[model samples]
Target: MGVASKLKDGFLSAFCLFLIGGAGFVVNVGQLLALVILPFDRHLFRSISTWLGSGFMIAGPFLLEDWGGCKFSAYGEQAPPDSKVLIVVNHGTDMDWAGGLSYLARLGEPFPGGAKAIAKDTLMYIPIFGWLTYFLEFMYVKRDWESDKKTLTKQANQLGTSRLPFYLCLFPEGTRKTPKKHAQSQEFCKKNGYPVLNNLLYPRFKAFTLIAMTMRDQIDGVIDATFAFEGEHPNMSKSLSRKLSCRCNLICQYHPMNELPEGEEELEEWLRNTWVKKDALLDEVLKDQEAFCSKQRKYEWKQEPLDYTKFFALVGVFCFFLVGLSVLMIVNKIIRRGVLVISVITWVAVVAALVINIRPSKVGEKKPDPETSSRRKKAD
Candidate 1:
């Protein structure tokens, strides 16, 4: 596709994704307010919010596939709906998680408890998307061993007690692989006498180790997924742009958790070894892309098309509640003036804060400290 065509497609796809996200944000705020005043089980409300919020978020990926002309192909056994899965994948592009989710949704069945990502704490602070993710109960880590250890433990305990089945998605590489980072990874590998990987960074074992130890009994399997895109070097913007024929090859290999080693140290070793095998697999694919693509096991999903009928209905209900709340506040004479004044002040404050926080950094500004950058990349 030409540059102009590509830009048009990208804009259209992004706009659609934004609309879906905006709807989700509205639903989240409405539900949160309801939970404060309504007499309902908090857990039940939380589950409902998560399901609705995730549904909204997942819609973006599917829409991207339809609108952006991105093709997805998956190879390997599909995780059963009842199973609690841990999805560990190499991080190459920002859209890796989105593409993975789209592929999973295409499977003939839905995951038992919906999937949640282990994101960086920074993501939880980004306006609408972040707020919605927080409402959905996604686990956000600071990437510091001292901090994340406690966070992961608490998350594990909560998941263990929850009735819903979950697919916990983790990117063990910790950050996206860039040329500079790749060089650093190769240097570390050489010093440690490990095979240098071209496509993947060395997997960080700390988070995986802690999670495995805490949730060993609860998880059913581990899905090791390697995502690759065709053509020249691909990144998030390119993936979303329809100018190039983007074909995503997602190879997923599922290993039963029971088959993995039990001891913490042994399990960490096993995980690292798995990454070595992944590097080898990526190398083989890179060497002969056509052969690898032709050999992948392809299956048609026999599921119904994604339905937004229920989502629209729920949105209407929330809108009605909000309208009623507004009317009630206005009709009460004693508090009406006070409420209006307070609402105006609150709106102004919120807008000012968002403007300051979302503003772009000045050109030629000094880069953030390494520690801050590291933490941001962990979440990115």
Candidate 2:
């Protein structure tokens, strides 16, 4: 991409992120109000918040397509609305999760109980967007098994008892794929006598196992989804570049939970074996993109037009809140001044916190070796 084009794409992409984050901030405030008003009705509060949050998330796919010129195709049987699902996908690009979730949102119907994911704890610290995940009730883990186990266990228990259905997305690769990480993974596989994957990292089976065992009764099936780009490998930067021309494809295979092994040890073995098949499948698809595309069911984008109704509804809600706040300020000078002072202080505090906690990590920090890092608790 030319420098000028790249800058335009970057600007558009950043604006989209800011728009989504701002929308999420409104939704999150509504969720907090719901929690206070419906304290006794946990299910009602959860459902209200999740669906509201999803309205904001719906913009993700559209923005990606518009800014990046990316096209997506998915081949798989759609899961039933009432059925709970676990989506186990390869994490190739930073946009992979957003793309998949956006596809779900565009599926003509609402996602079951609104889709949630097991994401890295660091994501929870991100400003408005991160706080939105909390409203959606996404499970965030520290990537350490000991700490994550407790969190997942508690979450699973809650899910087991709840009547709402969910599609819990998990990235078994544990991190985004990089050439350096791929090389490290190959070496680790060689030492461990496991198959080396060219396009993916070795699957981390522990988190998958814990989730399956805990929610076995509730989960209907597991969806094995593989995402591939048509041209060069597209990381976050490349995907955001205006010159990006790669069409993305997602192939999903569903396996019933009952068909999986029941015992934990047996299940672990089964998962390893499944990853081997996934490796081979990805190899075939990547090797001959044309042949693979010709054989699979093509996803028709026409069937899933962006839902403008929901988009406008969200905007209307936000406007209503803004107007109400303005009216309150006009009627009460003391309250308005107090609110302005508090808002200023809050913004300063947030900026200071980000500078202290987040900025340093982005500079002069050495990343852990991929080979050994897999065994440590960390987020993808």
Candidate 3:
């Protein structure tokens, strides 16, 4: 890329990030106002919050697919619309889950409650994205059983009772793939007698098992999704510059939760066994990319023309909201103060959510492996 083009790309990416972050902050303040005036119902609040989050989530996918000209081809039967589901996906890049928004958008109407992710606890500290999503109520886990159990169980109980349709997305690998993590994962799996994966990390399955057990009867099924990118994986810079011609191939499989094994040990085994299959499935995807294009096509890669009409509509609404907020703030100084107050409140709430410890779990948490249990107990 030329120096001039690189500078242009940097400027555009910065502008987009600034615009989205500022606008999201304004919208979240509005969300706080709505919550204050509206009657409280957990299900109703969650559904509305998820819907709002989904709107912001579209920004990532739109930038990648519409602006950057990335292509996506997906396989497997679509999950039933308006049914609760748990999505178990392999994480390849930071942007992998961002691709999910585009894939789900193309699948038809979204779930009533849209999506809530199981995010690592540290993400809550990120500036604008973190503040905005706090209102959207994404579940955050510390990855420590002692700390995570109370939070997960409380959150799961709420989810289990909700009649609203939603997607609970989990990256069981806990982190994105890297050479060091992959090597450590192989070591962990080999020593523990679990299956070792080459192109993926061994899943941290204890949390998955707990949540699945907690919400077994409530959710419909689980979706195992694997994403493969054919060329350079586009980050924000590559995406803004349109410097890479990227095609992401996604494969999914649906497993009904009720059909899963009952015991914690059995369920953990089931999850491991499932990952073994996913590892081989990824092997197939990588092999296909390296081999003859016309090899027996197990998954017919469909390159449908991506219609930008809906995305444009979403952008229009976003612009309108920002404009309306500008007009309101200009007209009334009190409203401007209210915005600052909302920002302060957001910070306080974030701190509380981070430091406040929930009571010990009444929910039956699976005992950690003997070696790890001692460390967790000490941490507690």
Candidate 4:
């Protein structure tokens, strides 16, 4: 493509991204208001969340598929929506997660509903987007094992026992692949007497180890999502603009947790071997995209046809909010920002305090009957 065409596509891609993102920001405002339902009725809170969060994310796929003309071919067995999944992807380009959402839509998994991802702690500080993710139940970590271990344990416990089924997506690579990071990975491998990977970084096994052990019994499926693009991996601009004939194909595999060896050391060894396998998969697909996209497989998952009604309704809701909030913020800047900020801050502080203070129920510990407690108090 010529430079002019590239520039035009980039401009258009960015504009569309903002439109969708803007709509999402507006929806976050509604999520903010919906916090009242959370304390009184957990079921209603989840129902509201499905629309405000996951329902809003449906636009991501529509923007890519309808506007950008990108097609994602998915291959694997995905757990039913009612079942629990732990997905570890070989994180590649910037849009990997977004594109994967297209495939998740195909597999009948919740878009971002109960589909929780581990995000950087920094994301929580962003005004609208940050507040939205916090309400969506995203887990944040700073990558320090000391503090992160506690955060993971505390958060995982909530999902571990919930009747709501969730698909927890993780990137064991810890971060995306880049020239500098790849060099570091290579040096670390050499120092540690491990084989160097040509296509993937050495897996960081800490978070995965802890998460897997904690949710092992509840986990229904462990998925490995391997992605390869037809051309050089693209950022949101190129990917959204569908430049370079950029196409993504994901070949996912399901492994039952009980089938794998249960020990931590054994699990680490299994992960080492898994990365070696992913390296080979990447090497294969780089040579031929057809290696996976067109190949026959045990399961062939089709993309769920775009939900135009839900998509437009979500975008429309935001558009409405945009106009209303614009005037409200302008007319009442002090009151608007003050109320929004205080509500979010107080809610976050309270939740953090509760998570820190709450203790997990002890296994096999008998609970005192409520009636008995009341009777004993009366006698006392």
lDDT of 4: 0.72
Error of 4 at 187 (Å): 2.3
lDDT of all the models against the reference? 0.69, 0.72, 0.70, 0.72
Instruction: Give the clash total for candidate 2.
Output: 1
> All candidates: CA RMSD in angstroms?
7.2, 6.1, 7.4, 14.1
Q: Which stretches of candidate 3 lie over 4 Å from their true place?
A: 37-39, 111-113, 290-380
TM-score for predicted model 4 compared with the true structure: 0.79
Candidate 2 has what TM-score? Answer: 0.82
Candidate 4 residues 66-95, lDDT tens each? 666666667766655577888888877666
On TM-score, the leading prediction is 2
Candidate 3: tens digits of C-alpha lDDT, residues 187-219? 878998878798888887778888898988888
Better of 1 and 4 by lDDT: 4
Instruction: Assess candidate 2 and give its lDDT.
Output: 0.72
Instruction: For model 3, give the 10-residue run with minimal summed lDDT.
Output: 356-365
Clashing pairs in 2: 143-377
| TM per prediction | 0.76, 0.82, 0.78, 0.79
Lowest summed lDDT window (length 10), candidate 2: 356-365
